[model samples]
Structure formats: structure tokens, C-alpha cells
Target: MNQPITNAEKLSKLPWSIGSNALVNVFVQLTFLGSVFILFLNTLGLDKSQIGFLLSLVPYTGLIALFIAPLIARYGYKRTFVHFSVLRLLFAALLLLTPWVVSNFGAEATLLFITVVVTLFSITRSIVVTAYYPWAQEYIPKSIQGKYSATNNLFTTLAGFLAVTLAGFVLDLTTGLTGYLVLIIIGVLCGAVAVWGVTKVPGGAPVEVGRGVMASFRDTIAALGDKGLLFFLAGVGLITLATVPLTSFVPLFLQEEVGLSSGNVVLVQTGVLLGGLVSTYLWGWTSDRYGSRPIMLSGICLLALLPIFFMLMPRYSPVSLYVALGIAFLQGIADMGWVIGSTRSLFVSIVPPEKRSEYTALYFACVGVFGGTSQLLAGQVVQLSSGVSGSFYFFVVDAYTPLFLLSIIFAIASLFTLRTVRSDTQVTVEEFAGMFLRGNPLSAMTSLVGYHFAQDESRVVAMTERLGVTRSPFTVDELLEVLADPRFNVRFEAIISIARTRPDPRLTQALIDVFNGTELALSNIAAWALGRVGDQTAIEALRQGLNSKYHSIQANSARALGRLGDAKTAPLLLERLQNEPDIGLQMAYASALGNLRAKEATSPILHLLHDIQNEGARRELALALARLVGDEGHFIHLYREARADFGTATAQAVSAFKRKIEKVLNSETKVLSTLGACADNLARDQLTEGAGYLAQLIEVLPADHYDPH
Candidate 1:
């Protein structure tokens, strides 16, 4: 029999678990560097069509990347990232070569070459970026994906803020060739730094993918065949169509229409990026707490108002221009909903992990087409109207056009799509337990687990417990009906809830009897609940479970024993130290021993942890030993060594370890000591207080060897 899985193990692969903040750094740097080209386009003597042509190259290359993305997938993200980086740097350097080529050759020839360079860069950058996209789904945990990806976008937007402003400032200071060359040189340097960042991001095993490019492309498109995914892709396209015009051509609009100075215009432009950057986490938090659709719909409605606000910008005084920029900032914030909403959770949730990159490429490819076409159309429309300067009262209008109205229409249209984007708001196993503690209807408890509601049947069982009254509102037999429900999550949630809230010992015994036959997920939840409620009466049953041959069951029992705080099982736990073969189990063992405050098992833990296979477990075990021994030297040594190993895997691992150790040391030193001083003999009763210190120590040890008895 297998032991139950712990909460920590279940969420190990989530992006935040892998130090999602690193992505924020990546986004900020890329956006800042990427936006420079947009700011300086007109200064290079490029007309509207010419600038449009340059921007058009990004998608043109994206098309090529679309084809090669699968091939890159074959080699994996790590190699694709490295290759794309080298190409980007080379292309940045290639931009510096542009002026010399144009000076020597004809303008048309030079422009053609510049377009080629942009296209190639765009293609390679696509592979680099898209390759990394799958990792977002792979690395981040499901619970926090929305928040982490949104925060990542927020940081990326800040880069846009600085890039737009500085690009304007640079162009404002230097002449045509000199400014362009300088921006390109800076771009190369940024690209080099970006390369370093990607290399540092640790990679896991590559997913099995289609062997060839065409087959991968086929699979990518096939992913959209899922109705949910199809709507998501459509939503992405519509959102991009609505927003790309604002980002790509807004600089030109601000300059020519508002008649603002270049420096001042850049500041106004910052409104969009800053607003976006500030609002990302809010939208993400909302999505996590609520659902993606409501937040997304709100953003779209807000975006629909941008055209109305644009009409007022020309009427405002210079000081009031700040107000206008503020509106632009609002537009940017609304735009954050689209970017954050479209890219991550919905995409990953609808598709399997193996096919994420392929599906993501299809989504972005459609985005490139729609986004690219909108920018080209906006530019052309502006170019045709550039010559029609109408004097409105005393004000001069350079390009007063109705094109922004199209943007407004697109945004409004997006609201209709929200109705189809459904996710459920249901209580989780954790919340179900909390509900019992309060003695209320669990159904009334607000939850974000609705996304998994339709997929699981046990939810009904859990709901029954939440709704059940002491008078037996529903028959006891109706509760047992939940076990037969085929949906795993539902069964899992129901069994756990029943075990927690129901007082019948026989019911618990029956639940425990059938627990072994349940799915790993549901079984783990049952085990966890059984342990949490301190069902000492079921200790004999739990002890029987510990004797099971299954690794998962054994591990769960180890954890349950710790939670039970039974010194009687200390020897059982200690005996297993030399028998378990799994590193993850060893970590659980260290954690369990620490939880029990089994000071008797300390030397065994310290000795076994020394030869641990996993660095994370070893680090945790060392800290546990320190707690058991009550030595400041152990704390210092653990802190110093763990910090040194922080960069190897996920920075989050290092941070998690540091936080655990510090929390333990701090609590033990302050709160616990004060209580111990006051309680005197009463201090011994606070077993968990000491257990807390040991728990941290055990959790911090390296997980090299786990031997289950």
C-alpha cells in the first residue's frame, strides 16, 4: 500500500515554487529593451508606412518561428533559449550595421535589409520566448499561476514604461544615424544580459513532443479543437486586436495629434505602461479569488471607454494632460487584464502540459496576425490622414481620426465572449474542514475551486457534510452514496469532509476501511484529515495503515504519526529510516520525527541525513538537528550553507529554506522563550512549541535516502 501525498509535494511543480520572481526580472528587461525601437522609429526618418513596415517584421518573423518552434521544441527550451539569445545579440549588432549599409547603399535597399534583420530577429525571439512559455505552466503551481504570471507581466510592463520614455529622450537628443546606432548598441547589451538570465533558469526533463516541425504544428493547431481552448484562442486574438494599436502607434498619435513636446509626450505615454504595471497583480488576485472571466470582462468594458477619453485629451490644458495620461494609464491597466488573462491559466488549464508549447504557438501566431494587421491598418489610416490638418477653433489637429473608434468597438465586442468563459467557485478540502470547525453549511463558503467542480463528484459529498445538521437533514446512508461517485476529486473532498465533521466512529472506521481502494489524491486527503483531527481512537487503524507495502501510504502514515504526536510510534518511524529507498520519503521522515519532537530519534536523523541524496532534504535535516540540539552554531552553519546553494535549482528553494529556519529560530528565541519562562513546568506541556523548532529542522534536511519499513 502507498502512503498519502502531502500538501507540499502536491504543489511542487508550480511556477512560484520555482522562483517566479526571476521572470519578473526577465520581463522588465525585455520590455524596456524592446520598446526602444518603437520610440525611435519616426526619428530615423521613417514615414508611417516605413514604420509600419518595420513593426510588421516582428510578425513576419513570428510566422517563421511558428514553423521552426516545433523543431526548437525537439531540442528543448534550454537550447532554443540559448540559440535565440545569440541570434538576438547578433541582430542587435546588425542594427548598428544598418546605418553604414544605408549610407553606402540606396535608402530602399537599406530599408529592405533592415526589414530582413527585424524579421530574422523576430523569428528567433519567438522561438526563445515561446519555448520559455511552456515552462510557465510546467514550473508554476496551479493555485498561484494567475498571480505569478500577472506579476511577471507587470514587471514586463514596467520595462515598457522606461523603454518608451528613454527611447524618446535618446532620440530627442541625437541626430538620425547617431541615435539609431546608440539604441541598437544598447539593445545588444540588454540582449546579452537577457541571455544570461535564461541560462540561469533551471530546466526539468523535456516533454515528449512530435518529432518534426510539421507534426508539431499539426498538434499545436489540434489543441484548439478543444472547444474551451478554441474560445480562449479567439479571446486572445480579439484582445490583441483591441490593444496592439494603442501600444504600437500611440507615440505617433501623442506627438502629431496633441502637439506635445517629445519629452512630455513620453511622460504621457508612460501612463499606459505604468497603469498596466500597477494593475496586473490586482487583476490576478481577483482572478484567483473570483474567476478569470469576471476580471477579464471588467477590463474589456474599461478599455471600451478609451476612445471616449481620447476625444477629451485635445481639450485639456498642459497640466490637464496629466489627467489625459492618467486615462491612458487606466487603458493600460485594463490592457493588463487581457495580457495576464489570456496567456496563462486558461491556456494551460484547457490543454495538457505536453502540448502547451504547440498550443501556445498557435495562440500567439493568431495574435501576431491580428495584432500585426491592426497596427498596419492604424498606421496606413493615419498616414492617409496625416496631410488633412483641420484647425478646430484655435487648436491645430495633425491626425484627428476615427480609427480609435475601431479599438473601442473591438473592446466592447470582447464583453460578449466573457459569458462563455465559465469556471466554478467551489470549496476545497481545506475549506471544507474549516467550515466544520465553524459548524456551518460548507456550500455557503465562498471558494475558487469551482474550476474543478464539474470535473469532480466528491464535491457533492463534501457539500452534504457542510449542509448536514445534527437532526440528520439527509439520511446517513445518503452520505455513503458519495463514495460510489466516480469523480475522483469529489470522492476525495467528500471522504475528507465526512471524516472531519461526522461524529460516528463506525462511519470513520468504514471510511478508513475503504480508504485503501481510493485514488492516490483522495486517499491522501483522507489521510491528512484523519491526522489533523487528532483521531487518537483511530491510532490502531492508522498503525495498521503504516504497515502497508505501498510507498505513498507509508509516507502518509509517517506524516500522520507526527501529527498525532505519539511517542509510541517513534521506534516505528526510526526503524524505517534505514529501510525506505525514496529521497522524498526521507524528507517526510525527517519532518515527521521533528513533528513528534522525538528527541530519542535525533542521532539517527542526524546520521541518516548526512548521506541524504537530495540537497533540499539534507539542508532541511541539518536545520532539524540544530533545533533538537538547541545550538546557535547549527543555525548559523545551516543558514550559511543553504544560502550558498540557493542558486543551483530554484531560488525559491533557498528562500523557502531560509524562511523556515528564520521563522523557527525567531519564534523559539522570542515567543516560545517568553512562554517557557512564565509557564516553568507548564512549558513541557507545549510539546508542539518544541516540535515547531524540530519540524523546521527536519523539513530543512537533505532528502538523499528514504527507507520504508
Candidate 2:
């Protein structure tokens, strides 16, 4: 039997609400660096071959960073942020130092310069990212983490647009050594700023603290235990690999084959960036509001179209460049979708919170391994094609054929991973009621087992609600066993029923195991259950869903987490609140937080209220916030503040409640005319009509407010 819900359940939810800010900072840094990458690369003297080789080195170096993510998890995000900033600073400094190092050492220093530059950038990028990735997983509510991740990416994309334009102008102003020096200086300054920005944001407590680096590594590797994650990585890897050919060589092809000018090349790149900026945010917002799977599938299907479009570019004009840009935009959407779908939140929800860092690090390691090989192979293909004689266009297109075909195959495979499973494993309805009423939880559990054997899934779900009134031990076992039932329907019914009743660790584990397939019913229910559970174990699973390719799953998850309530989740909620344009989701989040008594959620909640055009929702939220506080003094203060301002539904409720309390406590009471009039105004809305009754009782109540407002 599970323990009864308590104050601590609500408190744990608070942390999730607060730690999302750190992730926003990290994503912003990603955009800032990406925008300036080409400008920085141009400043180097390496030939085409050297540049390709040097670029390939980036992933290998990144692999090292991925390797150490466990250590960062052990030490805490605070230290991770420190490591990230220091490494980035070093990388930025190296960019400026590269020219001098080359000048001093001559030809002998060329390889060394490339190595140092790539090494520095790689290390900084990976370490910061490793630390940053888990921030969302650790803090943000699973329900909305997708949206938060997407919105954060959207902000980063906006930053990219601004940063690229500025970097381009800066590099354009000067020539040769002076120009390079200026770029290096700016890079250093920006890197430092990024680090500073991240450190300023508060982070969640490190779940895996003070472990040895090796132990951390072991944990990260252990994340592969989840079959869904393993397959998801494989599918995502193929997609990334498919993209490498275009992402790497598109610029060079445009410059050489199309005979375009440097300015035009910049324009093309800018166009691509703009596409990414728009698409990433758009998809992210949608993913957060909906779910990750649908969004992911949509993006993948669109990606298949890119290659076919690229093949048509041979006979096309500058308009074809637009087509290419559109394709890049679609690619950006897919990338964002992939990020959400593959979030560590998904893993965390399935696995225990104690294992989150280990899983995250392992996931990143897989990304690096697959992503690096793809880059190398892509570079080799491009290099080989460049040496071949006839029409470079056909040769390059042919080289990419395998990748495109593979992406299509994996995309189809991803559909299989889209099935939804139940949120937790628990007993059915009749069993629960029987257990509580008869004081025989085992009998109640047996009833559920009998129901499962009979395959009465619908009745099972119906009965689970009745079971929720009590928390019994045998009920937990019944629930766990139900999830392992041979029949899919039986397991699905059992999982969802448990989610509605209470969270079970076994249920969490089973969901991870069964997270594959195209049926989203189970997954959606499970997501909702995890959100309600409000434990660290479910964080990664929820985080992964934030960028879920499906809008529905993403939205439901966000809404669920908002209700779960944790301080760690506040910052992430705020990030989504700031960036997403979905009105419905915004309302759901406000309501969920209110119901969860998310005290620390005030800032973000208040911020959302400022722009809310919906009067009804705003008023409801105001009242809900008061209810959430559940403190007499605070409630009375809220009542007084609203009452003094003017006539509104909220004011009437406060006034009426005030009167009712006063009359009950004091024999002789006095009626407040303003409160009476307010109650009359409130009676028009059915939702607030109850306020009228309280208004009549205000005449005799005592002055002191009740605690359970």
C-alpha cells in the first residue's frame, strides 16, 4: 500500500517550478555560438580539407564532454555551470590566440591551431550542454517541459538572428588581422556573458550528488536500460545523419556550383537561420501545447521532402534558394521536435529520479557517438565527390541518396514508437473499493486480477476511481501485477487506474518498458499520472515529452505537471508562459498551479495574468490563487484589496465569505452595505452565485479570519 498524500508532495513540486530558468540560459548560449560559427571559421587559414577535418574533430571532443556529464550531475548543476563558463571562456580566448600561435610556430603550428580551436569549442559546447540539458529534466514539470524546451529554443533562435546579424556586421567592418582579432574578442566576451547568464539562474538540487566520476559514468550507461530510449536514439541518429550531408556542404555547394557571391552566401545562410528561428519556435510552442510524437512524425515526413526538392534545384533559379531555405526551415522544425521527443524527462519519468543524471549522460554519449560518425562519413563523401570529375551536383546528390533513404526508413520506424502506454501500474476500481470497505486489500486486488482475467478493461478504469479513496499495500501489488498482465488492454487499464489512484514506482518502470508502439492512449494517460505523481523519477520522461512531436501529449503533460506543483518546476513554467502563444494551455497551467497550491509559482502566474485578454480566466485565476494560499490573513487581504478597487466577481466572493464567518462567530452583527451590493453583482454568474449566501451572513461574524479560506 502507498502512503497517503501530504504537504511534502506539494513541496517537492515547488522545486520543478523554479529550476527551468537555467535551461533557458543554456539554450540561448547555443544559438549565440551557432550564429557566429561561420564568421569565426572564416577567420582561420585552414584549407577546405583542413576545415572539414577540423570540423569533424568537434564531435569527438564533444564525446569527451558527454563522457563527463555524470560527474556534473554528481557535483550539481551549479558546478556544471561553472565548468561550462570556464571552458567556454577558454575556447573564446583560443580563437583570438590562434593567429598568434600560428604566426609564432609557422607551418608546424597549423595542425596544433586547428586542434586547439576545435578542442576548446567542443569541450565548452558539450560540458555546458550536458549540464544544461538536464536542468529542464530536473526542474520543469513533465507536462509542459516540451513547450518550455521548444520556447527556450525559440528564444535561442531569436537570439541567433540578432547575434548573426551583429557578428556579420562586425566582421564586415574590418579586414584581415584586425577583423579576425575583433571577432575573437567578441567571441570571448559573448562566451563569458553566456556563462554569467546561466550561473545567475537558480538550479534544482542534484539528485545524484558526490558520486565518483566513474560511478557517474556507470549510471549514465545504465540509462540505456530503457528500450524506448534506445530505439528513439537509433531513429534520431539516422535523422541527424541524413541531415549532415546538407548541413555541412550546402554553403560550399552554393558558393562553388551556383557561382554565388560572398554576400549572396551570407544571404543564403541568413535565410536558413531565419527559417530555423521561425520553425523551431513554432514547432516548439506547438509541441509544448500538444505532444512530441505527432510533431516529430510531421517533421520527419517533411524532411523526406527536402532531398526531393534539393534534386530539383539544378534547373531552378534564385527562387530555388528559397526552396532550399524552406527545406532548412523544415529541418529546424524536425530538430526541435526531435529534441523534445528525446528529452531526458521521458527517461526520468520511467526510471527513478536517482538515476536521471546517469541516463542523461548516457543518452548524450549515444548522440555524440552516432552524430560524430555521421559527420565524418559526410565529410569523407563530400571530399570524395569534390575529387570526382563530372557535374558536382549529380555526384553530391548521389552521395546523399543513402542518407535520405535511411531517414525515410527510420521515420517510418519512429511511428512504431509513438504508441501511448498507461502512466502507472495499480489496481482496478472494484478491487480498490472492496479493499477499503471490507478491510481486505488483498481481496480487492484479487477482484482486479479477476477483472483483468475476464478482460473487462472499461469497468476496471471506472472502478479505479473508487479505489483512490484509500491507500492500501495489497492495492499496490495488484496494480503492479496488472501492468505486467499479458493482455494489452488489461495492462493499459491497470496503468491508467493506478495513475488516478496514486503513483507507484513499479508503474513508472513498466511505462518505460512499454513506451513504444503507435497507440497513444496509454502514453497520454501515463503522462497524466506522472504529472500527478510529482516525483523526480518522472521528470526525465516529462522533459522528453516537452519537445514531443505530438501537440496533444505535450499539452496534456504540461497541464498535468502544472497541477503537480514543485518549486523546481517554476522557472520552466515561466519560460513557457513567456514564449508560448497558446491561450488554452496558459489557462490550464494557471489552474493547475492554483490547485497544487504552487506558492512559489506566483511570479510566473502573475506575469501570465498581465497579458491575459480573457477576463473570465483572469478572474478565476485570481480566486484560485487565493484558494491556493489557503491562509486566512492572506485570503482576507486579497478580499479587501479586490473589494476596495471596484465591483467584480472576485470581490463579491471575498465579501460574502467575510460576512459568513463574522455572523457565525458573533451573536450581534452589522451588515456592510458595500459587501451586500457586491454579492448582488456576483449572483449573475452561476459560478459565483454561492457568494450571495455568504454576503447575508457578514452581519454577525467575528473579525478574525478562518485558516482554511
Q: Estimate, for each residue in 153-269, the C-alpha lDDT of model 1 and write its tens digit.
A: 666676567665665687679766676566556555655665665554545334455367777667666776787777766666676667777667765666666666555666676
Per-candidate TM-score against the hidden true structure: 0.55, 0.51
Q: Kindly give the stretch of ten consecutive residues in candidate 1 with the minimal lDDT sum.
A: 443-452
True lDDT of residue 488, candidate 1: 61
Per model, state how many residue pairs clash: 46, 87
Task: Pick the TM-score winner.
Answer: 1
Tell me the spans in candidate 2 whose CA falls farther than 4 Å from its real position: 1-49, 65-67, 168-181, 204-211, 280-282, 314-321, 344-352, 389-709
Q: lDDT by residue for model 2 over 1-709, one digit each (tens)?
A: 3233343442355333333333333232232234234434544544445555666655555566445765676667667766766766666565556567668887557667657767776777677666765664554555555555665656655555554455456545756656546645655655555555555444534544566676666666666676766666666566666655456555555555555543344445555556655666445544443345545555565666666655545423656566555655665655655565445225433445655566566556666666677667766665555544343445334444444455456455644543332122133323322434543454445554455455466665545433433344335655676667666776676666666555557666766454433568777777776776555576666656656777666666666665555445656655665567777667656666665566666766777778776878787567557656765466656566655554454655556665774565453434445345546655444334535545554533444642333
Tell me the deviation in Å of residue 406 in model 2: 6.6
